[model samples]
Target: MSGWTAHLPVLPVVLPLIAGAAIVLIDDGKRPLRALLAVLATLAQLGVALWLAGIAGGLLHSPWGSEIGVYAAGNWAAPFGIVLVVDRLSALLLVLTAALGLMTLLYSLARWDRAGVNFLPLFQFLLMGLNGAFLTGDLFNLFVFFEVLLAASYGLLLHGSGAARVRAGLHYIAVNLVASLLFLLGAALIYGVTGTLNLADIARKLPALTGADRSLFDIGAVLLGIVFLVKAAAWPLNFWLTPAYSSAAAPVAGVFALMTKVGVYALLRMGTLFEPGGRPPLFGGDWLFYGGLATIATGAAGMLAAQQLGRLAGHAVIVSSGTLLAAIGLLGNQYTPSMLLYLCSSVLATGAFFMLIEMVERNRSYGADLLAVSFEAFGLADPDDPTGPDDVVGIAIPAAMAFLGLSFVMCALLITGLPPLSGFVAKFGLIAAALEGAAGLTPVGSWVLIAALLLSGLAGLIALTRNGIRVFWSNARSTPRLQVAEAGPVAALLLLCVALAALAGPAMDYLQGTAATLHAPERYINAVLQAEGVGR
Candidate 1:
């Protein structure tokens, strides 16, 4: 590859880092300028991500004679210096993060950015952390990037001043602090035992260790798994997710949908890296299997019991996380391609739903006012006339409510895995693969997953149906005036989901290739360990 092409792996992380630093130096009075800068930076990041994905897909093949792009910082080689590796998986996630960042920032430009100091900077920093985490090839830097994003999230969670936001933010902060400590302890133990923090190096070294040393590594690995589980919001460890996410500002909550996925991403990377052929046989697979089932159950129960739309969305995030975790735990390569599709569908649907919640609530209040006025006017109409003012009430729904309702229904269908959408395609593919025992999944485990998938969809259907009725069918007085800034992003997100459905054939083909590559990690290991320098 050309020198410049080889450097694509690091740009996703570096661009946002520079922009965040620049935003921090700007005065708060120039809020408009800050927003503009954030938009430009995120757009550029998106471009880079798309380009890297092209490289991974062989659509932008280089002279380097390799599929993966590996970058070593400061001309340092692997096992001795920092490395950033971009394959199909990391490239895919980078694209997702950048797309979400751009859309969320656009929505925030309406008014959410003014809710707190340094909002623009924090947003950029969060993107930087997320990109860094996805691209980093070592456990130590993963912990560092994890902290970077979590710190920014703490500020964003409490962006608006309110008792609920503050209370939830505090709890969120406490839980993450403990998780970070566990991450550190676990990292230190692994580094001490293996004498390396690089993932490829660790995998290379695993089979050589004996007796007590191997046991020590296992303990550290389990501890690290717990840290990831907590972040993934698996069952008992997930109590804080719904409250914190539900109470945060809409834009913040929209972007936060990807945060839990970060945990899932980490687990996937590490779990596959340590599979039987490379290191110890996959540790914690059973826990992930059972924990995921419990997480699905918890999310379904929470969704059914939730009184507010935001909390319901929060539960939906938990359900998505559990679904992926369980699929991974089953150790079925056949399931990964389908799971990837479901992951994309869930993230987009949940993010759009979070944004839609505020608009729906606003319209409901406005509709209430309009209804009162209509009732007063009807009371003065002639009682004997069959087609008097009452006739107008039947068809008087506002355009904004119509838009919001349509968007809400689409979101509901996407989340619940119903027909004619990407959601159904994904869930069906997964179920088919599981039932066929394509990857050695036991009958009991397959049945459990089937039950979770079907029951969770039912729970979501009931919850969203009730909320839709209350928000639209109940009572409203006036039509809510929706702005392009508010409604446009929601439309764009839903349209993307539609597009995914339309392009299901190509998307599945790509994901299937990605799954195949992931299951065979030797190429990844070679790419990292054999790199000479940036342009070699």
Candidate 2:
């Protein structure tokens, strides 16, 4: 933790930004150099994240005196100027973002073209925004980081600009732009109320509100929540997700796995800021459980309705998003660490599957009709020469489809809070918190969550089975050779999924510790304040 302060939180963002810009300046023909920069930038971020997490954990362990690692640019103090703060919560999220960033980069390495116009630069910029969002102590700064992410995503989403890609990317951008506008509006209103945009300051100031001002403040908070809910793809606001995500390039979709979670992080972070010290922050309880219930239902229905793998994966993402949001909304500011724990793993798993969808697509040579025909006709297209175009039907991909099917089934269970996955751990924490909140009044909300969780699991199983039976069992043939370039990165991503499943115990403990520190922002506030000469 010694040199940790010197590097400060801003270095994480800066490192990536600088790297991305440098990548853009590199000659496109130099693919190897570009890849090197991309990988190094990602690795640098990972190292920073690990170091920051360790420092944060150490600080939290010794209550006698703990440092949150606050560094003010140009020695400027908080409330009046820009500041960066790294507490246990932000530190943990930084690690998640970093790990995911690193994984996505590695996935793209063997898979994506390094010499592309926007790939490396945009990716690095997106990380810059993500790290900034996690570390910034100011509301306006958060907005800036959000835009940084949005801008980079705009390029990444439309990378190839194929008809499907362009259409999906446009929708994604339009929907999020509106959301961004609303976010700005909400921030403006909050500034009007508190006269300061620092989150900790807002927290301290919001507690003093009363009468119409309190109502106004609550309304602003709700508006801000709406923006994040949209980002997180919560029920009514999630319409944009299906098209946008379904049509994107595989790696692009994989990267977006981080975007929606940004919404979750913002919601959790801002919710904690708005909530005062004490019992679940007033209306937090209802928001968490009810929102979660609605999200679960919608996601389940979406999956059942989806037909194609891409669309199916898109819907699954929605379902996972809803699960995380509902959990956080239910747990309030206090137990969000548990929610985040599940969220991080779920994001990774969802991302890996999304990437896998592309790989599966690459291996196929026939259209849906051809695939169906293969089931009926004995002359199925040759799996080895998918390009044969023999027009034969009635072939099958029993093995390949079966593997893909299992992955889908596991993903569904993972998203639905089933055991042996990180999803279960996250849900467990939230459910326990919800029951405690209910304190036993028949706990209608808790019952609703239980039912929703069960139903989602069942729905996911049926959906996966249905898809699997069609793709792997009944027909298929006409296969293509696996592109090692693409296959390698996807395999790497899958390994992450296995690790998440296998290492749930240590991950949960880390999450619990991070959650505890988040609930008590004294360390966070103190870290920033102390950087400005306030007492330890």
Candidate 3:
């Protein structure tokens, strides 16, 4: 690669940071100006990500081998200074972040209060953090990126501070703070053991540590896993998600689609470095799989309990969380690429769907109580309910509700691992890989995965259908009032969903390549070191 391309890793993350800072200084009354700036930054990030993704495909597939892209600041060497590495996985995740960021920005264009100070800057900072997380090749840098993103999310999540939102935000902050501390402790322990913070260097060095220190390393790995698991909202630790996500403004939550997946990405990246022997019996083995299955079961049950669109969407996210972690937990080299691809596709679908639900709710002035009534009646409630929370659906029977309930059913099925959609393709690939690896006990384990997946899918579908019936198809006489401009973002998002389904074949191929590259990270390590002339 040329020196010009060597700098590619930093541009995707930096563009957003600069743009976001610029937005902060701009006049708040300038709505058109803010939108223009946001759109430009988003587009630039998207362009960089696409270029990097293309470059990664060529590099990884090259017979000569691949190396991580390392950009030295002011010509500084890696260990003595900061470095960013872009490989197939990082590049792909950057692209996914850009896609989701752009979609959410579009959704927020008209949805956010133009005069609000926190809206634009906070989101820009959030993207900066996300881009940083994906590109940085250093462990400490990854933590910095995590904090940057989490801090921005802290502000974004509590933007309105409505009573319910405040309640939710408290829980969100508490869990994340604990997670952040764990991340720091893990990093500190790893740094203490290895004496270096560069991930590539650590990967090369980790294999050399055996004995009590190895056990210490194992503890650090488990701690790091705990931090990410919390972030990913896995089972037993995901209790805070429902109220927090459901109460946030729709567009805000839409942006958050990228947030949860960061944990999954971290786990995948770290897993590659530590558990490359495939599934080590310790931290990488059956524990993660069982925990993931438990998460799936809990999320499915929650989906059944949720009565509103926003809440249902929140629960759906948890279900996706289970699928992602479980896919990773049931790993093989072949499945890794598919899992990465599936996450990218799932984030798009879930984010788009989330934006749509928010728009529909705002247009209809629907509330939680109205949602409950509609669910019970199996019909759409009136949009003009002046009584606020007490509004009831007029008279649609269960049959009418069943018709509009199709969307929820599709969503449930999509997240729970049914076919035709990308979710099924992803889950199928993961399960097949697991079965292939299950020599002694894997058959029973694989069967358990399949059963949990099916049961969760059914439960989510039932819950989603129940809510959709009450909201969209109910005999409720709510006045209709959605302007085209209001729905434009969601319409654009839905188009992305179709695009994913249509482009599934090529996407899966890319994922396969990415997985192969991740499994044998020689290219990733060599790229960064070779850039530094350490091995050359």
Highest TM-score scorer = 1
To one decimal, what is the Cα RMSD in angstroms of model 2 from the true structure? Answer: 6.3
The sequence of per-residue lDDT tens digits that candidate 3 reaches over residues 265-373 is 8888877766542322323457777888888888888888877777778888888888778777765665676677568666866776676676445435454412343
Q: After superposition, how far is residue 344 of candidate 2 from its true place, in Å?
A: 1.4
Per-residue lDDT of candidate 1, residues 232-288 (tens digit): 899889999999999888889999999999999988888777774333332336777
RMSD of each: 7.2, 6.3, 6.3
Question: CA lDDT of each candidate?
Answer: 0.84, 0.71, 0.71
Residue-level lDDT tens digits of model 2 in 1-536: 23345555677899999999998898877878988998898888888888788777773332214547676666667778888877777887788788777777776665343223568889999999989998888989998999999899888877645566677777888888998898888888878877988887777777687778777767777777888888888888898888888776677788788788888788777765555632223224666557766877888898898788788878778877777766665645435656677677677777877877765665554333122433334233443565755322223434544455566566666656677766677767766766676442246766776667668867877877687666655445434334444445555555665676688777767776777766666656666655653222
What stretches of model 2 exceed 4 Å from their correct place? 1-5, 59-67, 114-116, 277-283, 332-337, 366-413, 429-442, 483-485, 533-536
In angstroms, the error of model 3 at 381 is 22
Per-residue lDDT of 22 in model 2? 94
Comparison by lDDT, 1 against 2, better one:
1
Query: For candidate 3, what's the RMSD?
Result: 6.3
Q: How well does model 1 score by local distance difference test?
A: 0.84
